[model samples]
Target: MARRPRLEPRETRLDATQAYLGRAADLAAEFAAGIPPRRIRTFSEAAPDDLRTALAILSEIPDLGLVVHGPRGCAVRAPGVAPLAVTDLDQRDTVLGSGEVLAETVRALDAAYAVTAIAVLGSPVIAINSDDIRATVATLGLELDKPVVWVRTEGFRSAVPATGGDAAADALLQLVDAEETEREPGLLNLLTSTRGPELAALARQIEGLGWQVNILPAGASVADIARAGRAEASLVLAPDLLDLFAEGLETRFGVTRLDVALPLGAQATTAVLRRVAALGGAAAPPAPPRSVSKPLAGRRIALALPTSWGLATAELIGDLGGDVAALSVPHLDRSHAAALASLAERWPDLQIHVGEGQGFERTGFLRRNALDLLLGASDAVAGALRQGLPAAVLDPARLIGAGAAEAVTAAVDSAFARLALARSAAQNARPGYTPGWLKRSPDWHIKQEVR
Candidate 1:
């Protein structure tokens, strides 16, 4: 068992380190060189799409409005759960400038919603035109009483989708008052995306310890985000997604961070609860013995999931008698290095693929490997199912606590039970891709450089 690092107050930028964490140094090196075996599809979401993620995070706060300063299409992407407005920019505005339109949009949102705070998000069009959204918001702030924050969402400039989330966090932190306050003991900021049953289950576990859980981003109010500075510490659930956000909070608010593996499966989850309890000065509850199911014995499983979930799910699958044949992570960075190293220690021979939209490579792997189960994101599951493989979409948020583990066990058993039916459907359906083409090297499309 890996010993947990002691929590310490420090001033450091987490993103200053490499993001990709993997035991296989060679594979990480290959990905860094941009010569992975297969080319993947480009992510369609621009930076503004992060508004969906940002709004989801901010949704916990009541009556907070988001003003998207771009085309109407941009506003359409914003989840309907929150009050939103769009600048409705067109060709004329793009050629000229949309500053006036943005000011009008903010004014309209202010009049329309009784929100405590409003976030102004820039779209790809604004980024392309290099519109000074910050300046516009600043000019409006001079007159508007409510705080107006500008979140940079320049999707065309970066490939990483989470960059927009980081931008939102940074902008949101600006709204947080820096004045020191008496630290609230046993108060923790749970920096993660938790929804539905998982949120309820995890909340019970944390609250059961007599500690207050403040879930950030998801469902967090503007006040909750601002008050995060007053928490005893911040516990990160999705380190890969929120490490930079946590770092920002720590730097600006003096709130220390507990960087631990995501709570998945019996052991990892136990570790998380115990650590948080200890940090909150509560007694650590005795962990129940883990129950392993033998249904997956002798089975090979492949995973395509977010970084933290991918690592934790691998452990759960292993406990359930499944051997992880391969794993696909969206992206790797410095935040993931420790987890990657830990995974490497456990599965030295594991094949790790890092990229977004690597359906081609996944298909190729499914063709070559005698995999019994394919668990991953919806796109990956669809690709595997088309190839007649029994697959399940791994929604990490939905898979929490021991109940979630059991649910996954049941899901695997059910998928295997219906394997024949899935196979028959695949056989009857028109094949999406030719077998010969799939059998070809994933690098087939690439022109090799000769020395």
Candidate 2:
């Protein structure tokens, strides 16, 4: 079993916020890189400071533009926001169905801005009545001559900003089939929702084996994706996005999809390079000396993420000679419980930790353990750090499985290696790391010293 971290109280409020946002930024980058590139229209019920942080991250997207929608039906210059167009819906109009108002707003943007696509940023107003916005857009012929994507971020402060980027990217990908063209053979299109820096490193590692790659939702074009059939094969990354495009490719273009795990270790990465080489009809280079060594032998790890992700992490972690420890899946709705149950039975030793209120808290517990390798969110890593334990963050936002286990494993392994180095540094630098409560309560510290 993976050794859990020592128990401790939660960190200070500031550290929690910093850790949360740090992870949020990584997720935002993932959405920016993986989803189709386009403009964004957002509706928020967040405080001014929270909104500013969200906007700061949105502003950093060179390819994505943001148009803010007001809150509480107010029509004023939002504090800290520069002048931008606003569409205010009064209470009467909102109650009476503001479809017309929304349609007019979209039409105005269509004619005024060069919007290639549109996504109704999910919020209370929209989530409660998304059908209204979609119907209004459809009814008024405000399609923007481009794809419209809907992302749900109901009642979320941080999740909204990142989900907005994801919606934009998904909307962009949906527009790919709209283009008609042919791609040259040997120019394989990457069928991932995203290709972040770590993912890009995996791509480069694959390229080093002598294959040309065109990452979708990143540098790939609609024409490129449409012509994916011409490529020898498609590497299915995130099963959700991969299935979406893979279905289209098979139906329209006759491309084969390779269902594999997202690679994250030495063995996993090597498997991916081997697959790419085999497909491209090239020979893989010799295995790295370290891979054959027992570098990850007997290491125990635990993972927690949306059930949208498979138990692939458990398998990959276990394959590396690590104990699965415990598997906690939150939001294991009826749609996903069967799959979860099967995996749990397969890895009986893996503990099943479910969360309260449909949200996964196992991820939090995993971080608290400070296991040899922890895969979860940035907050999970931060939670570990607050207790003086180092962890590797397996952010679904920043990393995706391009071709399956081998492909994703390679990217994850690279990230894990870097994280391992950072952890080593922290451990060496601070011999007596103190918990947050001890600092906040001076009396507690004095009493302990006296004892």
What stretches of model 2 exceed 4 Å from their correct place? 1-90, 107-114, 121-173, 178-184, 205-211, 218-232, 240-242, 278-292, 296-300, 305-310, 329-347, 354-360, 363-375, 384-451
lDDT (CA) per prediction:
0.68, 0.44
Instruction: Quote the positional error of residue 389 for candidate 2 in Å.
Output: 5.8
What is candidate 2's lDDT per residue for 142-195, written digit by digit as tens? Answer: 345554433222233332222233333333344455444454455555565444
Q: Write the per-residue lDDT of candidate 1 for residues 332-388, one digit (tens) a residue.
A: 655555666666666676767655555665567567667788787888777777778
How many clashing pairs in candidate 2?
17
What TM-scores do the predictions have? Answer: 0.84, 0.55
- Against the true structure, whose TM-score is highest? 1
CA lDDT, candidate 1, residue 392? 80
For residue 204, give model 1's deviation from the true position in Å: 2.4
